[model samples]
Target: MMMKKTVCMGLILCGMAFGTTAQTRGSLGQSDPKAKVVLDNVSKKFKSLKSVIANFVLKVEGANNSVSDSKKGSVYLKGAKYKVVMGDQEIISDNKTSWTYAKDVNEVTINNVDQSGNSMTPAKIFTNFYDKDFLYRLNGETTEKGKVLQNIELTPTDKSKTFFKVLVDVDKKNQTLARMKVFEKNGNRYTYEISSFTPNGAVTDDMFTFDAKKHPGVEVVDLR
Candidate 1:
């Protein structure tokens, strides 16, 4: 009778241990639990960030041995509308009307009225997370420049086409977003590094509005 009681106790303990392990991995692979922890901090930190304008240096490496380019310019993003002025080529997305204007080419490309997840601009990290339906996962972690970071991936449950996967390097200590990597469907990869962040700044809706009349000499060709 003593032997049987001991065996039953061991089996019960094993079953309980297995149940705990399975429940933990149900959220993710249990590799980087801190990734989920950092994402949860986003909404709380930026609740006061309504609109922002920032200057950023961008480096783009296209996958499949495509054209690799580097860009340095200013970005003006207000609410869901934004305009990126890089060289003479301007990208303006007004939520309702998305337009890409190239001065050298003298052509304007118009996007669909209801384009989803099209805005992967750097500013999205500050403003767009307020939406409630984003899905997150802890991909893994890596050490960059001697700083330990957790690679957190986000997939929008509503709409997105900017990339197939987005991997963000989250600071292990401060839980702040350090850098981000985007893998697009066209085999192009974009890596963005945030140097400085100014939260709760002054930004007006007019900053997002694009007026062709402002640039009278530049030709605008609508390619919707």
Candidate 2:
């Protein structure tokens, strides 16, 4: 499978690297400081977010002349454990196995840390960002929904399942993440609107486990 297809299953799993202003992108050393500040600051904030729950809306634009579509969903995370539901499509990570459910196809794909190529894990992206395969860039600041945000860009460090540049919107003053955009290699794009953050909430470890009996009719299609 193509890397874009793999990461597309985990939109937020979209990783970061480097870029210039909103208009330009290049090597990390050449990245604009303005964008770098946001990326660096946001990375710090996300690292501090041990657990959170929130809902968001996702919009995806396809490349290859494909059409665009939108999905409304909820994302919940407790440490590395998370669950995201985009309309009928769902993704759940228990920190052990990542289960992605596609209602449209009645399919469930299962993957662990090693087999997942580490690209499907969003938190891992932050943990290994220091790797030399990537660079950083800074854009400018803008206001989105009453919040002052700094726009930062990230590029990939290596060639994997996907290689798409990422744009992260950070809260300039509070050093929080507001949103992100994933530029896919296939010419498709995805934008994430993050809202309703409940920091340091209660999330149990059981939420990450895969229980086919609990989901009942939900088929467990272990792709791995």
Candidate 3:
């Protein structure tokens, strides 16, 4: 369940990071201008796209750097709507309502979108959230599979957060996000690798909502 929740949050973060204009509350004292420029380009590239479809792999590693679990998933995003499919869980949101479906139990839970406080909703974590939440600096570039990637290291300003540091890898050639790694205070690391990203993909509005009728014997739990 924790992994599912993390994936859901990561998907929402990715969708928002590229889908909308980011809000900046001014840069921190240690923030690097070079990293900001790279992030700005990424935001511009994503905002110009009509829609996005991405295939990603999630890896969970222990403190000792041993892989404990891994999962492959895909995310579909269009405007404020998104659908994430990973393993037996599917989280669908139409910007207003959300449905979490668990295939193993054949149950789906529905709830209204929460927009209050510091909720991890896309509305709250829109593009360039690092500008508001963390102090970031450029960590230079690295090559992976012949593609040049710009790496940026980020530290949270608020120590109360679960994750203490985040590493972002941007595809320098395309100015798109290629990967992200989150280091938690509890000695756990979560890495998300974007295996493939498709921009301006064809998508339908109906795809952002759950259709209980399609799943026979599936129980519905509405929390709205």
Candidate 4:
């Protein structure tokens, strides 16, 4: 249960790695044009890449501004396929089937990918998700680590969503996503900082799947 929750959160962070180019819905009357321009540039940049490999740091904070957990992870994305590795957990999907692997137990769970809901996926990172799901505005700029970052604040359109707001920091010079912070209603905050990103990385379809033959005595739980 804990691992599943962690993977879900990690996927959400990964989904926001690239902005979208879709048109904003009419409900987003407050959306900022300037922010959309920045996001559009990011979208165009990511769309030109054939694949991406990114290293990131995830930080979870409690309501009292105390850090609860921190983990470093890497994600590989190519078209509709993705693989995420963090500590002892890995989530991989090939746009059809999904696998969740736990290294500590040497167990892997398999299931079908459900694209009917608002569930975030690495492929959605390139879709126009923000235009339909969020109302955003430009929140000014700040200098971080000697780089000028344009801050954009986003509010979800659906009131029932678990998260209330998301803060995105875009690298002004490169027009790439730099950081993202999600604020939940329960006072839990999740932050993802992109440490490094490599576009057009060498990746193959087999890398997105698990091979039990490689792991001796591995257990497979087919939940699909």
Q: What is the C-alpha local distance difference test score of each model?
A: 0.54, 0.62, 0.74, 0.78
Q: Which digits, one per residue and each the tens of the lDDT, describe model 1 over residues 1-224?
A: 22322321222112111111112333432333455566766544544456555555455776776768665555565566666666665666667776666665555556654455533443446433423434567777788788888777764343334445667776676555566666766787665555545554576666555676866775554546
Clashes of 4: 0
Worst 10 residues of 1 by lDDT: 12-21
Misplaced by over 4 Å in model 3 are: 1-28, 121-126
Candidate 3 yields a Cα-based lDDT of 0.74
For TM-score, the strongest prediction is 4
Model 4 residue runs over 4 Å out of place are: 1-28
Residues 1-224 of candidate 4 have per-residue lDDT tens digits of: 54554564455534432223234466556789999898888888888889999888888888987658888988899887889888888888888888888888888888898766455675565445576677889999999899999999988776666677899899999887888888888898888888998889999999888888988998888989
lDDT of 4: 0.78
Clashes (N, CA, C under 3 Å) per candidate: 2, 14, 0, 0
Write the candidate numbers in order of decreasing TM-score: 4, 3, 2, 1
**How good is model 2 by TM-score?**
0.73
Q: Which pairs clash in model 4?
A: none
lDDT of 2 by residue, 1-70 (tens): 2223335455555432222123222433555566555566656777788776666667788787487877
Identify the leading candidate in terms of lDDT: 4
